[model samples]
Target: MIEAIEIPTAAGTFDALACGAPGGREVLLLHGFPQSALEWEFQLTALGGGGCHVVAPDQRGYSPGVRPEPVADYRIEELIGDVAAIADALGWQRFDLVGHDWGAYVGWAAAAAMPARIRTLTAVSLPHPAAFLRAMTEDEDQAQRSQYFTLLRKPRVAERVLLADSGAGLRKIFDWKIAEDRIDDYVRRLTEPEALTAALNWYRAMHLSGPTGPVSVPTLYVWSTEDTTVGSTAAMATERYVTGPYRFEMLEEVSHWIPEQAPEELTGHLMRHLLAHRT
Candidate 1:
């Protein structure tokens, strides 16, 4: 059974959903933009069923308690610290890490900043920061793909457009395969007062200035063939940044919503990669 609880960190407290053996080999799951710990419902159930301890937190601005007003509060450094502090609070000196979308970006930073503490990393849907930066500079396609980041950074405009007609604009971004009820749940969370903006600050205050070097820990980077947000250029370029064991799994015909739309397949990939690196 999934337990809903408050997790205290140095930054503040986060509402998290946890399952599995509390003392089993720990795994921390971080969700991405416009999503929450609820998005990992499947992974939490699957991994927890497999005798693993799992905690998925509604991160930073996503959690009402941890929301800070200033956009600067969402910068990469603070984001990294939140993940580290959350792990520390969980009494895990080191634990397996998994993240999707913006959470994947934070995972890359967390692994780089606290390599000794991140036993292994499974970064889904986003590539390493440096590779992404390089692609944005050199690849026209990737730059075009990333244009949405600019739109999302705008203040009142984004809120209105995304919330218009009960989040029709926001709903258009996802594939039709995602259940309508699931979309409704995500939309409701984003429409909460101050929630969407705080989440957007992650894109606005985004700077590639943190521990964004080559990762030295065992890692798995998963990308999708049909992901319109992250192009193949950066996805393939991700190999150069990992100094230790690395595995790249590409899901053909999969969209950006990998975990939600393709849960079973994604879980298999995560379990194989993480189990291989277990201490």
Candidate 2:
């Protein structure tokens, strides 16, 4: 079973769901926006079965303890710092890392900034920030795919639209990927005004001034063919940014919600990657 606990970070305290055994090699799983640590339900069980400790956190804005009022507090640097703090709180000097969507973005930044602290990186659905920016500007398909981000950048409008009708707007975000029970949990967390704003702050403070160079750690980039949020151009370009051993896995007919939609395939990829590069 996964246990929820509060982890104190540099920015503040955040909630994390821990599974598997303690004192084993740590694997930190970071969930994306509008989601919590529950995103890694399958992987947590699988990895635990393999005697690996898994810690999946709600992240800064998503966790009630760490939500900051200022939008700037959610910058990439700050987000990375929060992950670092969580690692520190857990007494993990080095650990395997996995992230999805916005969590993947934070994972990239953290791995880049502190290479020694990360054993391997598995980023789901999103590419490196530089690769994403290049695609956003140079690829028309990527630009078209990212149009929803523009809508989300609007402060109150995005919140109201998502929270309207008892989170009907947010419920549609899950569509066919997430189960009804899971969607209900996301709705409950996001209904908190601060939680909603803190999640959106990630979009608001996204900037171009972070590390864009190649990642020095072993990495895995997972992409889905049918994902509406990322295009082929950006997905293909992700390989160029990794200087270390890298693997790319493309799932056919899957959407952006990979952990929920294709948990078996995702777990298979993760197991292979982890086994191939165990430290």
Candidate 3:
């Protein structure tokens, strides 16, 4: 069973969801933009059922008390620090990590910053930072796909565009594949005062920071063939950044919302990867 809880970090406290065996090895699941720990409901269930302790947090900007107004606060450094702090607060010297979308970016950052602390990493829907940057700079398809980032970087305009008509634009982004009630829940959480802005600050503060070097931890990267935002170039190039054991799974006809759309497949891959790397 998943339980709602508060996680204190040096930055602030975050609303989080936790599951699985109390004494099991730690697993940290991070969510992406416009999403909360709620997104990992299925993974929590599967991993928790499989005897791994899993915790998914609302992340910096999404959690009310932890939201920092300055865009600079949302920089990659602070974002990575938040993850480290979460680990420190949990008294976890090392943990397995998983992330989706922007969460995947943070996962990559964390693994790069301290590979020793992350026993395994499963990044869904995004490749490593250097690979993505190379794709964005040299691949026209990826560059075109990322144009939305430009709009999201605009502070007030993005707020108006996204929240317009009771979040019609934002709702459309999910393409109605997610249950209406679940989408409503996400919208409700984001529509809270200053919530949307805080979420968008992550995009506004985006910078690739060149190559993060190769990751040494056992890693798995799952990407969908239909992920419009991440093209073949970046997905295929991601393997170069991992010096340790690596696995790449591609889901045919799947969209970018892997955790929600392909929960079983994602869970299977995650379990296999984690179990294989277990010491």
Candidate 4:
């Protein structure tokens, strides 16, 4: 069963969804921009049923109480700290970490920053930061795909542009991948000015420093061919940054919304990775 809960840490209070028994294996899932712990509902169900304790929090900016105004508060280190803080609050001495989209960027950093505390890592729809940064500089396709960053980094402009037209632009980003019913709620939440601004602050504060190093935890990296946000250059280059056991799964026709759009396959990979790496 999934339970809505709140976790209080030194940083702030976070709204979260948790599943499985208190003593079950630990797993922490992180959602990316414009999304919340809600994105991991499917994963929580499957993994919790499989005897793993999973918790997905409305990360730093998404959780209203945790939202801070300064862009510096949204830096990559703060993001990584949030992950550890959440885990610490959960009483999880060690846990399997899974992340999607921008969440994956944080996962990579967490794995590198606190290698001993992470048993395994699963990153979806994004590659390692070093690989992605390199691809952005040398790969035209990736550079083109990332051009949208220029706009998202703007303080108030992105909030205006994305929330415009009743979130038509934002809703369109989901395309036909996310369930129609789920789209409205997700879009509506982001339509709130403070929420949208906090979400975009992630892009504005991104410096990718800690994530640029080698990740030493057992890791699984999932990439979808149709993911417009990430490119083949970075996906293929991700292996170079992992010093521990690594597995890369390429979903042939999947889009960037892997958890919602490809839950079964994603669950399968996650289960195998988790079961194999149980410490």
Candidate 5:
């Protein structure tokens, strides 16, 4: 069962969904842009039932209690700090980490900078930041795919377009594979006061392309054949940046929304990775 709870950290109080026995090896899941902890619904069930403790938090701006006003407050460093803060709040000395999309981007950077704090990492959709930066500059296909980043970073305009018509624009961004009720839930949460703007601030705060050290922690980077956001050039280059034990999973025909679309395949990979590396 998914347990909705609050984690009050130095950053602020973040609302979260948790599952599994409290004594099980701890795991924290980070959801990506335009979504919530609810996006991890499937993983919560699978991991929780499979004998692991898992928590997925409504991160940074998504949590009403933790929402900050300035875009500067949402920078990459701040986002990374929140991860540690959350762990501290949960009284977890170290735990496995899983992140998707923007969350994956943050996970890569955090694991690089704070290796001791993260036991293992499962990053979905996005590759290593260093590789991604190289791809954005050198790969025309990746550059083209990232065009939407421009719109999301636009102030006022992004909010107006995305929140208009009960989030028709937001709905358009999601694939048909996602259930309609879940989509509606996302729309309702984002449509709340200052929610959409704060969420978009993550994009405005910093470009995903940046300098990140080689990750030394054991990692599982899952890329999808059909994910238009991250091209194969960056995906292949990712191997160069992970120095420790690494696993690259290529999901055939799956889209960017791996957790929602291929939860079973993802959980299978995740469970094995976690089990193999457990303390």
Candidate 6:
């Protein structure tokens, strides 16, 4: 059975779900905006069955225990620090890292900021920040695609629009992409005013910061062609930001919800990436 646990951080106590046996290699799973650690349910089971312990956190502002008020509390540095605090709380010197969407953004930054604390990185959906920024500014397609972020940056209106009609607005965000049950979970979370604001703060706190420099750890980037939020330009440019061994896997016709819609394939890519570096 998966167990929910709390880890203390400089900010507050963060909630996480853990599964599998102790004393095994640890995999730190981080969930993205508008989602919780529940997003990693499939991966936790798969990795646990493979004799790897997994810890997936809801992250700050998302977890009720660690929700901070000010938008500045959700900056990249603080987000990355939360991941580090999770690792420290578990007494892990290093662990395999996997994250999706905004979680992937934090994972990318964390790995880059402290390469020694990460064994391997599996960044799902989102690419490195530098690549994304370049694509956002230079690629008109990306700029157009990201226009929704401008709306999300707005304070209370974005929250009301998302939570209106029992979160029908949030449901429309997923449309026909994510599964119904998963969409329900996302809507439920977004209904909470603080939760939705915290998630959006990740965007509001965006700055001119680049990727923490080229990552030295072995990494795997999973990009989906059908992802509405990311484009081919940024996806393909991810390789340029990694200084160490890297593998890029492209999922054809898959949406941003790859972890849920294609868990087996995602797990396969993650297993391959982690196992390849075992020896």
lDDT of 1 by residue, 153-207 (tens): 8988988888899899889877575888888898899889999989888988875
Candidate 4 — worst ten consecutive residues by lDDT sum? 204-213
Better of 2 and 3 by lDDT: 3
Question: Candidate 5 on 175-217: residue-level lDDT in tens?
Answer: 6768999999999999999999999999998753357899999
Those runs of model 1 whose alpha carbons end farther than 4 Å from true positions after fitting are 208-211
**Candidate 2 per-residue C-alpha lDDT over 48-158 given as tens digits, one digit per residue, 9 for 90 to 100:** 878898999888888888888888888888888887888888999999999999989988888888999899999999998789989999999999989989879899999
Tens digits of per-residue lDDT, candidate 3, 192-213, equal 9999999998888875333366
* Candidate 6 weakest ten by summed lDDT: 207-216
Sequence-dependent TM-score of model 5? 0.97
Model 5 residue runs over 4 Å out of place are 207-210
Top of the candidates by lDDT: 5
Off by over 4 Å in 3: 208-211
lDDT of 6 at 233: 94
CA lDDT, every model vs. true structure: 0.91, 0.88, 0.90, 0.90, 0.92, 0.87
Flag regions of model 2 displaced more than 4 Å.
208-211
Give the deviation of candidate 3 from the true structure as CA RMSD: 1.1
TM-score of each: 0.97, 0.97, 0.98, 0.98, 0.97, 0.96
lDDT by residue for model 4 over 118-233, one digit each (tens)?
Answer: 99999999999999999999999999999999999887788778888988878888877888778888888787658888888888887633445899999999999999989999
Model 2 C-alpha lDDT versus the unseen true structure: 0.88
Kindly provide the TM-score of model 6 when superposed on the true structure, using C-alpha atoms.
0.96
Clash list (residue pairs), candidate 1: none
Cα deviation in Å at residue 12, candidate 3?
Answer: 0.6
